[model samples]
Target: MVRKIAAAAIAALFVPVVQAAGWEKLWTFEHGAGTSVAGQTSEILAFDSLNNELWVAGLKGVDILNAATGSFVQHIDTTAFGELNSVAIRNGVAAFAIAAPIKTDAGSVLTYDTTSRSFQQSYLVGALPDMVTFTADGRIMTANEGEPLARPGFATIEARGSISIIDTTKDSVTTLGFSGYDGTTGLGRIVSPGAKPSIDWEPEYIALSKDGQFAMVTLQEANAVAKIDLMSQQIVSVTSLGLKDHSLPGNELDTTDRDLPGNVSVAGNYRNAPVFGMYMPDTIASYASGGKTYYITANEGDSRNLEDFVNGEFNEEVRVGSSSYVLDPTAFPDAAALKATSNLGRLTVTTSGGDLDGDGDYDQIHVFGGRSFSILDENGNQVFDSGNQLEALLFADPALRALIDDGRSDNKGVEPEGVTVLELGDRTLAFIGFERTRQSVIAIYDVTNPTAATFVDFIVDADSLSPEGLSAYEFGGKYFLAVANEVSGTTSLFSITPVPEPETYAMLLAGLGLIGLAARRRRG
Candidate 1:
């Protein structure tokens, strides 16, 4: 349902939403449906700009999607190899993990040929593979989910989670241990304190900065994200978070403080805290725009109780809802302690806007929950709140009320998993991809306007697109959005073209020539 906000209010309020003609479905590949490797489909994995193809890895095989034709060009049958969990492509080579039947001991790192479209030998010895990435110097690295072994009471906790570096050129692997982690070597339930075994948290996913110099992986169990210096082959820092931060003054730390009834301390294996539920981050993304790098993470939801913890009776307070933590990970050790400091309210400062408080260069960010979305400026301050605005605008008109109610509807609302920016007309449109639905849908909003947004139609069939990972890149003057469908086991492609009126092009060309002439004069 398209709801219209007056162009006048959008201009006056400096809102970000601008109108687009409409979103049309481009194409869909049906070959991925029910495609399994080891009884599981190659869930959508990643898009490779270097190769101009989509990489889909699953329990059964890996399929390459041809971007131009929207068809599977090749498939690497892995039924003989094992179940695959993650896949990454770099320098025209794709490396992935093969998870076996059991959880803990199932991972093996394998490589694929982009030119030949064939599987290379598996790098077994140091292939502690969970998430795979390439170093700046072109070496393959796997953030080992550790040896996936069952935890004490809760069966599956296999990933003893660690990181291993593989020199693809030399075909050698080196283990880079995590700090404060020690447990059994293989599939066994054990924890020897001070194992200093390094990396205990189950690192679910890995993200690299544009330059590929910095790599960050999400550690679900440890409640942290580790930053690795690829070239140095060392971990620069680990940002640790937990429920202990949520507790109030008088709260107690007994079983009563947790969600799972009975002694949670004994559940010990998973470190399931009462208020934080499971404080593992499910996803991570990186963007470098306007001279700064930003890392964004999505936390499913917090179940721990902050009220009880803050009473100070409990050990920790659970800060539920979603959180946005931004900083230059490059400034470590000095800013290491700052990892604990979230701009809880308005901690960041914005240079472009009047939001400069002289603190960290914080740009405002927007967050959405089940019902609403919010934008907070750098001062750790909130600029506009949907819940608050809804209340105030409730008395506007019955039509407006209906529009708000419809927009806020449960089924229609999107759980945004990935966001990308595109230049549409004279403005930049933020294209947000949704989870919870297999259909590839893009929700467009003018980043310049927070209050106004346009929800576009879904890309492929609701039954066909189980998009999980999204990476946007431009090639040959055409824009493409690559989607990894984790469920259907394929990567779907979409082309984003900016439609500009004749007058718009004329204005842009005129502006460019003036800049070019000025540059020539300066050189003379």
Candidate 2:
């Protein structure tokens, strides 16, 4: 406990904006900054295009702000409804997903007229609707997580994860569950010892298809994704996102939080290891490229320990070098030296699966996350993975070196949590938010080609921390990205300016040549 506290304290102590694009911080809004509810005012936000207002969801309620200036215009106290989870706006209407105080029970989607700030309609849905999104045609969808409340010596209430669809035109709701795969080996990754796949799979976020005919829900803990055919309201496929092989060259990672003598500067210890990481993505977004739909995910990992719950004591996580975990001598001939603290000893990994020969010893090591963002095909196959670049960039950048919590190196580096994409001219820019970093560190990538993507920049800001949600917009001839920081309870806006096109550069060179010729003529 003492070591854990000390580690937390140390972790707390810790942009290519000039190239492909330049960015500027426009304004920020603090939610309940001075009141008792300070630093607890936000989780998600949505922009009402028609009303030109941004609706922010927090514990207390919703805060309405001027999207143009980041000024608070009004507040709506929604405590009576329940715990607010997410907000989405479309046309002139806003939908708020509110989970019941007891999240295991049913939740509801409340719609409001953004123009009048008044309630319009309500539709009951599934439990713990963590994310709400709208199609361009006004179809509403929610990813109902249905998380379990666990305690020792007590019965756990396990609610099945589900997706809820609400048809605005029909004023009806349809909730879909994973009952068909409950008893089967359908959920690809880790599953709770005695829990069915239906209850074990928790939906974290939702991303819709371009044509509004399908939706993909992120089953984060399961390390899988479910494709829903919106036209049929059926879960067409559930694909396991597979694992990241750290043995590969570019997939290497910094494995420990070893600080120097004075703890004044954090040093990076990066290398390849005999391990694999489950791509348990928390957030995902879809885009169309070359007639193909590709999904981008921030590979944030998660683990659940049964010892911490009322379920059977089978912890999913254990230190790689722990006595309880054994490496098969046949697989790892040099296991002793590999167990060093600077090596894999201090690295935390999942223990649920790995015994290839059933000899009660692991032949492979599996960690929680990939520590990178991945671009996947419509079938959930990885087309491209960032691989070591996130950590490489962190150690490479002098400005971000101090912010690289060495404490997080042993676990998920930077902990890429939120993901959103924007269209800048001909380039598709992906912004990945790191939650575990000291402040706001957003990694931008140009993912024009699914097979080959390039890193654009790494943008950071002290005003934002632990960004839980991101929304990118283009209004008034400028592109802006809004970040909702959970820890700071602040919503920040940054305007993006892209680099000139090749044609523009050609024109400039031509004009410069003309000026040079005129100067020569004048000299003659």
Candidate 3:
């Protein structure tokens, strides 16, 4: 027991020191310090290589910063316009934001030309745009967070949510609208004013597949993620991550007596239901690995109880670390239909199977939570709902659980808003980022092995990293992680050099010795 205790102590010592050392402070950008139209930075940021710079968008106009020095480059004036909520840079031209005038029913999408250094074109968007992403083929996909339709005496009032897709080459933009909850089939669920009493349903963010054929969007106030098919323009998959049962008649706001799996049926007549069932999903990412496309979104929703329930201030604040969905692009009916209901599951990585490894293994998903970073399957089911065929759950240890739980606490690790899986040499590494709030961290995981994966400790910490939007790119034979910081109002470029593990180093030395001996033999 003494020996085991000593070993545990040694292991614990390695945790804080190593994790803290991994993150290196790259750069800091004070948005308003020296630049025009500067104030608090919004959580939305993006990279535009066409102009060879990083674009930071906030409540003010858009700021273009030098990617290398994190220096204040230039700011696009949107004062003639309105507050900027989203930005997209493509083909060397930048399109920042679209918004309505104060208390006015007017909004437009503004484009900034990198070559001319001028505002190029302005197109109309229906509602207030929150987030925007570039498609695989250079299309601009934007999402808004206002109610799309309104009706009195409706159980679930439709939140005016709009997604705008812009074809840059043709300068043509299409706007698609969706209401918060569609109860036509008696299948939709939502919160009542009496139950929630505080929250409102709205869309928050958007992301797209590599080919731009599919889009995964987050309805923040709605507390749901909808999968939209850009081709057919229909919502295909809708997943709710909040409580489902409702108390008041025609109300779907309710909670389970005990925490139940999100996909399972909730208890009937749940009380104290909130306005939206699911929490707010703040970020979204799309990646294609192992021949499957996955749409990952960040859930940063805060939970608050009704005023009458406690008569005091109490925040239940349930946040899903990070969740993802996978769907076949060909199976989607249209671009808009991608948000329709379908088979969707949480993104959990485990050796117990469920397609977590992309290997046809049945027992891959291990039951675990408190993960701010995750990768979803291209096939949808996080873990194949197989009977307990595997002997034991993979990575089913308390240490990992404790780490996740601690990391998920509001005061501990902030919301992991960005994630990307990149190919490092012959292996694959998952780059995860937690942002907003002051404490930001980036974690690197060696995910090469389908059954066994290694956490390379914390590769980046709060000191050097405050990642808002992260993308792993390869330039000049080196791996670079482009981090967009919301609070700092700057984006830094990080170089990820290959760090060989102890076993790999030992193997390399052994192979070299063997080669030297063979050469000596040949010489003799």
How well does each candidate superpose onto the true structure, as a TM-score? 0.57, 0.88, 0.61
Task: Rank candidates, TM-score, best first.
Answer: 2, 3, 1
In candidate 2, stretches whose alpha carbon ends up further than 4 angstroms from where it belongs are 1-18, 35-39, 259-266, 306-314, 502-524
| Global lDDT scores for all candidate models | 0.44, 0.78, 0.46
Score candidate 2 by TM-score against the native.
Answer: 0.88
List ranges where model 3 is wrong by over 4 Å: 1-26, 35-42, 103-106, 147-159, 168-171, 179-181, 184-189, 192-201, 241-280, 303-371, 379-413, 436-438, 446-454, 459-466, 488-490, 500-524
Ranking of predictions according to lDDT: 2, 3, 1
Output the number of the lDDT-best candidate. Answer: 2
Displacement of the residue 376 alpha carbon in candidate 3, Å: 2.7
- Full-model lDDT, candidate 2: 0.78
Instruction: Write the residue-wise lDDT of candidate 2 on 480-515 in tens digits.
Output: 788888887888888877766511111112321111
**lDDT by residue for model 1 over 1-524, one digit each (tens)?**
23322211111122222234234344555554443224445454666777677776665667777777766676777666665667777777888777655545535787877888676867862324656766667777676666434334354343456677788778887766565334433211112222333533556566666677777776644546677777786777665432221122211111211222341212101111112112234455554444434444433221112234234221122112114333333422233333222212211211221112435532321111211222322111223322211111221222223222222121212334444455554544454454543244434433334333322222333544445566666677867666665555445556665534311100112321111000000000
| C-alpha-based local distance difference test score of model 1 | 0.44
Ten residues in sequence with the least summed lDDT for candidate 2: 515-524
